[model samples]
Target chain A: MYQFNLHAILGYFGQLPSSILVTLEITLIALGASTLLALPIAKARMSGSRVAALLARAYVELFRNIPLLVLLYVYYFGLAQSGLHLSNFWATILALTTNAAAYGSEIIRAGYSAVPTGQREAARSLGLRPAHIELFVVLPQVVRVILPPFANHCIGVLIGSSIAAVIGVADLSDWMLATGSEAFRYMESFLVAAVIYIGLCQGVAAAMAALDRRSRRGAY
Target chain B: MFATGSVWDYWRVFVNGLVLTVELSFIALVLGFVLGMVIGLGRTYGPHPVRLACLVFTESFRSIPPLLLFFGAFYGLSYTTGVTLSPFQASVIAMVLEASAFISEVVRAAFRSVDRGQWDAARALGLRFWPALRTIIGPQAIRVLIPPTIGVYVAVLKDSSFASIVGLVELTRAGLLVRETVGDSLTVFLLLSGIYFVINFTISSGALALERRFRFAH
Candidate 1:
């Protein structure tokens, strides 16, 4: 019976940067795209129009509830059949963005809701336009209120990027799988991958903590 | 379009997949809760090294994608140790590991939110550590823990779909199979999404109701 080889796994760390970079790229792009998408949906959610509200609600519920892997497959394969071929990178990005946008919209909407209605009314009493009120008054406070949850969502998107491996995206997970297959040192490859993921996540947590501290200082 | 198979065909596969998913989630949920409590408490009061180790474990698991963990357990461990695990076992282990991290945070937060005065009062009353915890801390902590615990269960249910990549044949895999056979990807996916919607919606609503009941009771 062969015991797990710790030394060989340590060696796999040499190739870690490339895989980590791919995963980061996917995460950042998806996060940026999803945040942009979420803003409109969040606004629509708060809109008085029933159709807009319903559409926003359905989008959030559907995307948030569905498994991301299934969504990726449907986008990759199902879209392919319809003659709309997206690269694995794009497909995974699309899926992640759609999924993140749904959840992000809810988080942002909650933040918006937390903004006192009197503040908006107060802004209106000053003869501020609707757009001006939203932009100059509402959005800044909403951003502050939602910062922590938004940070959590970003962490979620970072982790969710690992699903990209299924659609053949050569992110950290895919690289780990490939490295394991090639080196015939599966445990080592995976251990390296795991360490990298852990490191990255810790970095994120630290960054979020620092941000939270900074935000609190500003608030005070 | 390929001919539509008998209703029994898709339904049977879906039922099988659903059962596996539920089983996977239940096992992970139960195991995760236990492990999470241990780690959570450890984080709260253990020595520095123990707290650091638990912090590392929790953050890493929380940050890394569940799919990566699943793949790592399924292929990486198998390759390294030459010990093959069943897909279900691999998926469950990965899910438990991931769930434990989040659960630990939930539990740790619950523990912290309990007033320090309660502990002081318990000690003042001459109650010992374990007894004070059982009679005072545990009950109050449970109220804070239950809602987020339900949220984690729903998250696990949704995450179990990632098991399909390693061939566990869960709900998502069943959808893929239907798509492959019927050549109607959209229809299959839509149906699959509906199933997930129903399951998650029910869980969330049930959790909210329970939360409300608990709030009133308190």
Candidate 2:
């Protein structure tokens, strides 16, 4: 009974590119920031100090347990009440970054563990300081081992970034929904958004798989 | 900056919200599990074309943003079909689809985790495909399946908070309501986070127990 208007959605083609750009921008910013932040947290977690490890563990557990949307509410609206103004863009970036970091740290930590113990012993026997061992022995290998999961986490972040739309970020989801409401053709716009999201995520996955293959080939 | 009485009132509202979250997640878990089993089995054991179809289904759903599904159900379905769904209904549909995507992957992985020889063993014993799968492989796969499935459930519970965006008055939505009334977004959200943390932490700990049981039984 309902007439679907694909043209109505196509009318927004000019705007869709900008919205998609915003989404990619958010995804990259969140992914990069999360990876940077995760390094220290992963290091602290693996540190021998009990207090440091405990604090790191607590941070991961709390963030992983609580929903990212709830945390976004706290950071954006909650902090706003106390005069901490964050633009929609920065608010989304921060929340997604923090959330991604928790998961990234876990993945990176697993990568660190996966490196054989014999390698560590070799570095120790070579009279390397802890810093040298970490820099030379751990960093190179960890980067390679973590890439696959790290790429997976980036894909996860890319998908999760769509949540930014609900907070008025003008991301693809927001733009599509707004186009629908404005044009009174919700189905067309919504279908377009779904296609774009699925396409973009698959693109990331394909890219990651290529990189994974390249890394594996380089391993020999 | 905070009053005890008002805090208590907010607590009541949050508890109400938590109950809805639980109900929503429970429905999603059950429905998704059923669908996941079918998809997983089809992907793992069905013919080449059926396996390809299952692959497309699971991969597309998994790669798509869940918010897109919510938007599709709430807005697109309404537009194209002229059938309006309540926010809760729309949300449950999204949750079920998303959970089924992830759970199907878990199930497929569980199936692969079973020794390939188990199938050969069943066939060697003259058992039929259905009977062999039901009796020999099913129980073992369930053991491998449970921990990851619980992990997925925690994810579903957390994502149910996202349903609030579609106008479902679940836990996160209730937090927003309390923030509006009490004018204490920080305390209210932190309190809300505490509740979520507690519930998810309990589920995660349960996953550890399940994983341990799986290992011990193996």
Candidate 3:
């Protein structure tokens, strides 16, 4: 029978903070970049121009269909051959940001569709500029609709970031693999990593839930 | 600049890898659906304890990364139990376990979409529980079940790529092997991505069209 060894993994506890910080850094940057990209993709999809909408649809579909792992490889390895060398960290960010923006655009598009056309028309009649209309009129309503799914995607980026360890990014899962192999305590190391991930994910969910509640309260 | 000639030399390897990837995905999807049905039914109709158990199972699975499960299956299992799994077996077990947690929610939601009135009507007709579910409720619930289920399948397909990390020699791994031989990373990965895109896009678009058809039927 295999004995459980808590002490084996304890020595590596010092690496936990930096590992987590790397994961969070990847998650936050990717989330922000994806959200920014999503706005334009959603707008283009909702735009009157057929070519722009078609281009946007193609972008969403292409990225949505490909795996994050494959995309990461393309950025990390593929681009390096073409003479654009990126560090694993930045490559992971680019891959996650591009892959996630497709889903984010869909979520944002749904939020846009959820708001009535009459609202946009009304904003226009009030002589609000188109940019102001999107910002002031449509965005407020879209926020509540988009927040929960966006949070889920935020959590998704966090989870997806774990795969970055495959490409040699020193994130939480990378640390787990390193420590586990070094100590020959793969189970114990995994348990530690799992606990940290569950905690971080739950923290994100709770924060999103609080934001959701506060948004609803303003509506009431 | 795109070199198809060199990469094409490994066509047999890619084919073998593609077959294994599909085979892995199919087995996991079938087993996951069965497991999901049981958990989903229990969550939807069982007592409070059963419901709580199902909730906990799904939430815990969903919150953790699937990669961790892969590691747990591939490494942790052997470490703890002295029972080693082949990489393929480990991948299947890990994928099925995680996929079921997500699928169970889809099943529960699909079941719930059928109104309480339908249940009452079936009971009023003197049909038994399973009989009523098969004859009356199942048909209606299927409409809600299918499209999202396809979404899950696409996820499973995408995730099967992770098996390569565990040394399973699937499509992604095959691509890496070919890349090593050919020494052209851009061509190999782009080719892999394109193949994945074709399969995934076809399935998803089919699901969309089917969803539209169902909506029109309603």
Task: Name model 2 segments beyond 4 Å from true.
Answer: A124-132, B1-5
Candidate 2 vs candidate 3, DockQ winner: 3
For all candidates, state DockQ relative to the true structure: 0.57, 0.78, 0.83
lDDT string for model 3 (B46-99, tens) is 899999999877777777787888888899888899998999999998899888
Worst 10 residues of 1 chain A by lDDT: A6-15
Question: Using lDDT as the measure, what is the rank order of every candidate, best first?
Answer: 3, 2, 1
Runs in model 1 lying further than 4 Å from the true structure: A1-16, A125-129, A213-220, B1-8, B79-82
Error of 3 at B218 (Å): 3.2
Position A7, candidate 1: lDDT = 68
Chain B TM-score (model 1 vs. true structure): 0.95
lDDT of each: 0.86, 0.87, 0.91
Q: DockQ for model 1?
A: 0.57
Q: Candidate 2's fnat? A: 0.88
Which residue ranges in model 3 land beyond 4 Å of their true spot?
B1-5
All candidates: TM-score: 0.91, 0.96, 0.96
Query: TM-score-based ranking, best first?
Result: 3, 2, 1
Model 1 agreement with the true structure over B1-218: per-residue lDDT tens digits = 67577434678888788888888999999999999999998998799999999998888788767877787889876765688999988998999998999999999999898999999999999999889988999899999999999999999999999898789898888878877787877667767777888898888889999999988996
RMSD, candidate 2, Å: 2.0
